[model samples]
Target: MIDVLYFAWVRERIGIPRETVTSEAATVMDLVDELRAREERYALAFADLSSLRVALDQELTEFDTPLEGVREVAFFPPMTGG
Candidate 1:
């Protein structure tokens, strides 16, 4: 199982801060596909991948990043300086 964390609006949309997911996805995009398939809330939260940033094991990564042995995956909107 992998810990999946959602932040900001993503969390609000999904109605949860985090979850444990059992997945066979090889890449972040693959994992997203699985989540998006689970419910409409997930689909809405992940609707625009371009507006989102991802982190694997607390290190920023791309959607194509491999998920092998990763213990955590976090999704949030792109950060901006105030």
Candidate 2:
């Protein structure tokens, strides 16, 4: 099981902060496809991939990154240096 974490507007849209999911996805994008197929909220939250940033096991990474032994996945909007 992978711990999925949603932050910022992602949490607001999904109506939850985190969830533990059991998936057969090989990559982050594949995992996203699973989530996007779960419900409309997930679809909306992940609609625009370019607007989001992902982290694997707390280290920022790309969507195509493999999820072989990842324990955690975080999704959130890009950070602004203000």
Candidate 3:
């Protein structure tokens, strides 16, 4: 199972802070397809991949990142901090 965390507006659309998901997804994009298929909230939350950033096991990653042996996956809007 992978711990999927939703931050910022992504959490608002999904109505949850995090969830543990068991998936056979080959890549992060595949996982998004699975989640987006599960409900409308996910569809809205992941509507624009361009506006989102992802992390694998806490290190920043891309959508094509593989899921094999992944322990965590976090999704959030691009951070802008000073």
Candidate 4:
């Protein structure tokens, strides 16, 4: 199981801050494909991968990063300076 976290607008769109997902995905992108298949909210949230950033177990990483032994995955929009 992986703890999937959503921040900022991502949380708003999904209507939840986080969820625990049991997946067979080999990569972060594959995990996204699973979530996107679950519901329209997930589909909308992940529609534009370029606008989002991913962190695996609290360290920044890419969507293609392997999910082996990972415990957490977070998704959020890219940070910008004010």
List candidate 4 stretches off by more than 4 Å. Answer: none
- The residue ranges of model 3 lying beyond 4 angstroms of the native Cα positions read none
| Clash count per candidate | 0, 0, 0, 0
TM-score of 4: 0.98
Cα distance off (Å), candidate 4, residue 37? 0.3
TM-score, candidate number 1: 0.98
Candidate 3 lDDT over residue span 1-82, tens digit each: 9999999999999999999999989999999999999999999999999999999999999999999989999999999999
Better of 2 and 4 by TM-score: 2
* Pairs that clash in candidate 4: none
RMSD (CA, Å), each prediction: 0.4, 0.4, 0.7, 0.6
Best by lDDT: 2
lDDT of 2 by residue, 1-82 (tens): 9999999999999999999999999999999999999999999999999999999999999999999999999999999998
TM-scores, each model vs. reference: 0.98, 0.99, 0.97, 0.98
Model 2, C-alpha of 21: deviation from truth (Å): 0.1
Model 3 lowest lDDT segment of ten: 65-74
- The window of 10 residues in a row where model 4 has the poorest summed lDDT is 6-15
Each candidate's lDDT (Cα)? Answer: 0.98, 0.99, 0.96, 0.97
Q: Candidate 1's residue-wise lDDT over 1-82, tens digit each? A: 9999999999999999999999999999999999999999999999999999999999999999999999999999999999
Model 4, residue 59: distance off in Å is 0.4
